[model samples]
Target: MTNLAKRIIEFVQRPGYMPMKPKTLAKKLGITKKKLAKFEAALEEAKLSGEIRFSEGGRIQPKAARGSHLGIVHRIKSGDAFIILREPKPVGLTDDIFVDRNDLKDAQNGDEVFVKLLQRRRSRGQRCGYVVEVVERATNVFVGTYLEEDESGWVQIDGKDYPDPIWVGDPGAKGVQEGDKVVIEMLRFPTVGQNGEGVLTKVLGSRGEPGVDTQMIIHEFGIPDEFPDDVLNEARLEAENFNENDLTDREDLSEMTVVTIDPKTARDFDDAISLKKIEKGHWLLGVHIADVSHFVQPGTQLDREAETRGTSVYLPTKVIPMLPEIISNGLASLQEGRTRFTMSAFIEFSAEGIPIETRFSRSAIKVTQRFAYEEVMPIIKAKPSEPIEGVSDEIRELLKNMHELAMLLRKRRFAKGSLELDMPEVRLSLDTDGKVTGAFEAEHDESHEIIEEFMLAANIAVAVRLNDEGIGFLRRAHADPAEAKLKAFSEFVTILGFELEKYQSKKHLQALLRSVRGTPQEQAVNYAMLRSLKQAEYSPMEVGHYALAEDQYCHFTSPIRRYPDLHIHRLVSSLVCDNVTYRGASAEDLIRLGHHCSTTERRAERAERELTKIKLLTYFEERVGEKITAVITGVERFGFFCRGVEIPAEGLVHISNIPASESYEFDRQAMALVGRRTGDMIRLGDKVIVEIASVDVDRRELNFKLLTHTASKPPAKKGAAKKSPSRGKKGSKKPNSKQSKPRKKKPSTRKKKSAQKRRKKR
Candidate 1:
């Protein structure tokens, strides 16, 4: 019976309530008299089943609101859960609220459930709760394999743990077959004792299908794979119409030596550089960016769409563009030989890369050449090849000079503790059918850094100008890493036999970074340090970014894909033109905008990873049982995560799969897990070999078996402990009889240092 229906029948069968007035019943039940009459009628309908009998002059006692613990379910594991109470500090609440194997009652991770606050337990500061009511359910549109035929099959989803099989109803099932990757919509949320219903919303593709990974990526990131019709129509209309009046009062740089340098695969050219000699000591270095603000105005449909997207998401196989193709790839693109509108930054720098003066202007520019990174790097390195088509010798010399200045500027920036982190980017080469024929690392060469330096200079210049005027503007904020996290990281690196210099200023950080240069663990250390820091976000606050060591920083380079850049364009154009009468948003508005963009940006990141995981899973299906060298990327109670050094794909090495008798202990502060009995540790960045054991494309999970040199005796097996099957139909390997329980590791031997030393001296 439905929950609501059952509650109503129970109320009518209360002892001694058959002859009460409808008004009294309504008041007692917290409902109107008419609703109470309906409840009475429902009881009569149930008489056909002999499940209800009317009683006279009876009333049910009201249940009082009892004290309860309120918190979001942090996680569910081993028939128990950890809850994070909203009101507590440090967020370490002990809800060891045991939900026995048979009593989980359909609870899912991240659900909002209220548990009766039971008496205090032995663990200090930890509160246990008996789950009273489930206020909400965590529902996600899942991608899984379909499992049925005869046009009446159900889909066995990947994440849900089911006793009785849960499946999608027949009509809700699209034309998906067994093992097809399909998207399903939750039809019902799981209640206290029932599994929720769901239906198949879309049939993405079969397992190991090309391009399906990208589809999963966009979906997981909550990015729309296709533009809404209204947004598309508006974008198309904006492209078809243009006016000459749009260029009024703009500086015309059509005759200058303007050039664009980008990757060969890049489509939208949003930025370009121009060089011209104004005097013996002064040269005009113009950094021009496409004026996307002129086309996409605030409050317009196009503007809303771009703002919602925040930034374009780039995947290995495809690009989910922030703007429609009509603008991003066609009109707004600053392609060579095409006339485009730009907001240019003109900086006069000395021969030694010191800025003497700066000028900002809205201008019309025509690019004369477009050179790929590989083609331009040689020219900048003074080893010139054949001249770029339509480029003069003077312009080549200007390019060389620009390269020299950019390098110096980059050196200064990094010297200020900017963190010289350049992770390897995974690039996929796909065939015409979109199958990934090859995957490799894409390196950032000198050509990429040159353009980056110029863009950075331009962005900083714009932010400083706006801040000087006392106007509200979007500033990218990156605070110093938390003291706790930094301390933890320091302990970790020190344990690895590295000395991190302690300093009072950003210079100290830079010194430590220089010491790790060219080391094998350089990338690993960089990744760990980065994790200790918070993400950069947009804000109107004057607090500067500690990492960049900049007094001002803002987004102004890529307006086509990022909305904040468009705002920067409008603000700069108004200031440059002395049109200060224009009204702009306040600081509060910018803060709100930053919060929204930051949240959506995280969503976009998730989508990208989901797609990558699916492709990686498909890639592994072909390599089962093949051994590959990998690095320890993560460690948990369940297993150690090893990422292939060459492939960028990661898999798990479960504790049960470890052949050593040593127990594993996780160093929470050091972010590493170590083995106790055998002194066999699996720390982050340790190299090891693993063989692919299983792959679950539907769930996008990979499992690997560890290759150990010595087979340590296994722990005694408990009676009839069933092993959870590895995702495929094949039976999983049983634990060896010699395996033993891993011993808990002891605390580190290092002395705990005081935080007073970390603080700046007054």
Candidate 2:
């Protein structure tokens, strides 16, 4: 069920809150017209089910709230599961409530199950919970591989776990063969001795097929892979009629020579730059973004589809675009030599890149040139005797000047306490056949920096203007770090030989990052700094960006790829163009839209990251048995995670695989593992030799075995207890073992003393 529908159901069953009208509830819950169908369906379902009643004046009232935890079930291969609770959870409950194997009942992954919270057993030292009832089955469709075993057809659900093969009971096994990846609708869930019975519905493809991994991710994430016919028809008609009225009365900048600099593989040119020299030590800069709102009018079929997708999903093998290709890649894209409608931010700046005055306008512009970052980097850096082919020195000089101003702007931002994080982005190269050829880190240079500074300037300027007008809209907000987390992080950096107070300030943290830029510890320090900051999200509130140190910030570029940028474009057009006004979203509507867009952004990021990891793991499948020296980036009681400087992956060396000489104890505060007898220690910033043991693509983990040389015989295998997997300090690994007992934290002396003192004072 949709999140909005679930919320409506919960509200209907909530006590103390009176029944509300459908229209009133939609407005109060911040639901848009696009989602009214879902809201109404949920209301009808609840009333028929007797969970709610239709009172006088057509209001929804609850009978009584159910006594269970409502959450999505995510199951593991060993049947251990975790429920990620939806909002309005029980008071004082952690977000994740664990349900063991036996407690899972017939629950599957992605089910919204109502569970009962049970007390933790003192002897077992574990918190136990079970699925009291399945409130809603998230999906009956299963994606799996069809297999033939023991003269019977079976479908092994991909990424799902069972103790034995799931037999496909002969009645539902038609039209599917062995080795095919197929989607099936389950007729019955599995029981003690019987496997889940399913009817084969649609065939995806054969196992290990090209582009199958990307498709699998799309299915798993519930990403809409294809545009509906109605949406496609609207997009086509909109593109076909773009240049009619768009060219009239808009500021005609077709005479200006604008350039679009992007990656070599980028097809959609959403933003471009135009520079004009006003006089010596002064320049007029134009950042023109494609006017997506002009084509995707609100409440249209195209708008609803785009809003549902929220953002484009870019995988290693393919891209699931937010808008139809005809729009995102055609008229809406500011391609070179094409006159396209745009929303331009004209900012006059001095030599220092400080804006003298900022203005926004609706314009028509023609991009004169498109330069890849690799080609423009040299011209910007102005290396000695670097020759430019087929380009005039005037263009080269413009790029040089742009880079100069961008540097000034970057320096200004850094001086104002902006955090420059060094996070690496890995992109996979695919051949014509869609096979993973290799993986490489994406390169960034002055070309990228220039665009970034220009975009930030425009965004900040627009946000300032909107706030001055007292306009309530979605703005990016990043609150300061929590005091408790700050204290913990302050203690962490002291091990790296810096004063705890130094790490607290953004400027000092930037300096610390600079100091470790090229050192072996750079990644570790970067990770810690990243963890110390709050995540930036969209909100209607005017909270400033803590990391950028900006009082006002919003995404104003790349409207084709992001929804908030489109909203900003609409607002800008309204304020600039006399005929238009931004009146579609209320303050409450903006708040809800902001939260939803932020969630969609994170979902897209996670999908992209997982695809990259899958591709990168495939790249290392060729070297599974190779022994490589790695830097220990994290440690735990189970094992140490060593990052491969040369390889683009981190693998864990489980504790059981360690040389059988002495037992290892984990020091939580120290973040290290110490040998009890040998006095040998494996800690962060250390090196170790490890041989790659296995790679599980479904789990997206790379496992390694320790190769420490010791003069002792290896332990025998007879009746050895199964060891739980060791994880790196980052808490990224998941093991298939039984649920672990929670460890009791060591009592702090200071806390005990403070408690005693409080009692005496009372």
Candidate 3:
């Protein structure tokens, strides 16, 4: 055979081929045998890398179960790495391991990795191991600062072990300069210390720009920037009617005095309440919640998305709604003068704080007025304005009576060990352009407390029915306090000459709150106590809310924003539709539901906190070098954190900022940053002056310089005559007016020793 034909014959001899025939080569490439011969040698000379060589038949194979372990990476901190896994363990047959640096493959912090565990070790009584594989990347979106080196630019992702520097090589690559806040899309993973190429997905304006920080936060968290078009269309279509056919089956309460009390800017009035006297010693209170469940059926496109989101995310500048705005702020909102579908709970109570009776129903209610918390607070305080067009005299009277009943209920709740947690929220004041101009603490007054009490009562009533009927329902449940934290908190308070009341029950916690009510450290102690309690979550358990001291607590109101509330509404409505009583829900379902809600809640909180931190950094940038009085809220070995009293900004005082002459250390048990040399300390409530030194908006960090308040030195003692000193010579000069005598340098040690010997001879 000729050289070309011989090459073709060799290609056909490969193991992947069944025949060594030249005709088979021509058929595979759809070319003549003569054409295939030209490139035959190159095709037969293919090569594979060491890692790729482990595949089968030139195709990569997934690791088998017997030897493989898979888990989602939570984080890769300095000391060790951690991943949350479901079951399998490689460190041992049963022990789930925590991976170390060498074992970790090219895994980003939050990626899903197939780790080969090296060994399991106990550190502080915890199981940890060394990871060996990074099977996949979780997200391509990276929050980072564009960095410049030599003549090229890249993005340094603000995450752990992210050795890959995303290279900016494209035309728009030079748009974002060094130290600029930007988002980078990871195109490919580069080897350690090499530049990984990326496209600049977004350039959040220059750092420290107001509103840019919050916008960056929204992008960094992977939160939706805009609503999907399809969801908006569905919301519009679903909102087309308020037909009589729908209202026929619902109770009509349009004649009642139903008004919503919320913050002035509230667009979604999901809940409203009304009150009336049933008898000389009895009263009827109605809590009406917008029946969002009726319109958005379960398993529908809108419902599915809402379930995935779980709840609406409220940020300082914008809202990430659970549903489209059309429904959340329109149809589902109980707007005044518009009749809307509602889930009503009629709770009757006696003078002695006992519920005489309760009834739940679907209703058609027309809200008479929308009263802001600020507006109704005065009326509740018995200071009423002239009845306006919407608010009649009778409605004003009804509000007054409701406030009284609510006060009784509130007192009773506190008696039952309802925590008086001092949770003061920071309200951001923004300009028309959505820039955070300033931040102020919001106070909780009677009007706020009154609305809270009735809502709590309504939620409890719904929970009672669901529990009694034994149906699958969503209930917000809180677990008991962690014993260790409680013990620590108790020990902390004892140092201040106080003792925590025996927490035999929620009632005991109530007593503790009451005892600390008028003290200076009340709010601090309250915050600590609140932190000790478990977060309330959606569950199937019949157990009551321990913190609220209520056994019938359920999230039945606010269906417009909360998914669990919608689920509860559906369960109750389903029970009514099926002509059945309540049915107890499965514990397993409850656990699963609770887990989702808890996780989502934490995510929302973290996102909110991140946004706040960013905004705070921006807020501080404008006020750098300005002085502000603050309270030390937290302390660490690296720094002490303090929050401004007037502004909502909090910043850290790095250890370097502390004067070298003074000694400082963090006191863990006392929760104080104490100065050992001066015996001056900063604790949870200690007041101190701090100057805003610098801000890193991208990192959402603020640095403060502590201004030492040194006590004024006593006036210099009298009869201390200043002496003359030598000028360009070793010996001292005599004092004379014309001589321009220099002041004596405070005697050097050698001069002092000679002078002392002369004085002794004298």
**Model 2 off-target regions past 4 Å?**
1-142, 148-154, 160-168, 171-174, 184-199, 244-246, 277-282, 350-352, 383-387, 496-499, 579-582, 661-663, 708-762
Lowest lDDT 10-residue stretch of candidate 2 = 735-744
Superposed by TM-score, candidate 3 places the C-alpha of residue 18 at a distance from the truth, in angstroms, of 36
TM-score of 3: 0.76
Judged by lDDT relative to the true structure, which candidate is superior, 2 or 3?
Answer: 2
For 304-344, candidate 1 gives per-residue lDDT tens digits of 78877888887767888888988999878998888898889
TM-score of 2: 0.79
Estimate the lDDT of model 3: 0.68
Deviation from native of the Cα of residue 181 in model 3, angstroms: 4.0
Which digits, one per residue and each the tens of the lDDT, describe model 3 over residues 460-567?
888888778766577788767777767666655443334444534566566556666655455567777878877777777666687787776788888888888988
lDDT of 2 at 109: 76
Question: How accurate locally is residue 497 in candidate 2, as Cα lDDT from 0 to 100?
Answer: 36
Best model number under TM-score: 2
Please tell me which predicted candidate would have the highest lDDT against the true structure.
2
Q: Write the per-residue lDDT of candidate 2 for residues 1-762, one digit (tens) a residue.
A: 555556777775654464566778878788788978877776666555666654322445554346666678888656788888875567977457788868877887777666777877325454457887655565566667778867777777765354455656663354666777777777778855567777777767775678776776776567788999999999989877766345775899998988899988987889999888788688898999998988999889999888778888887777788899999999789888888899999999887777899899889998888898888876766654677676777788778878878888999999999988889887777887666776567777778899999899889988988889777778989988775666566555444333333445787677667866765556776788788788899888888999899989988998999998988888888888653555647764586578778867887888788777776676667778888777777777788888765665778889887878777777665566666655455666666678888887655678888885322111212211122111224544321111111122224656789899999999
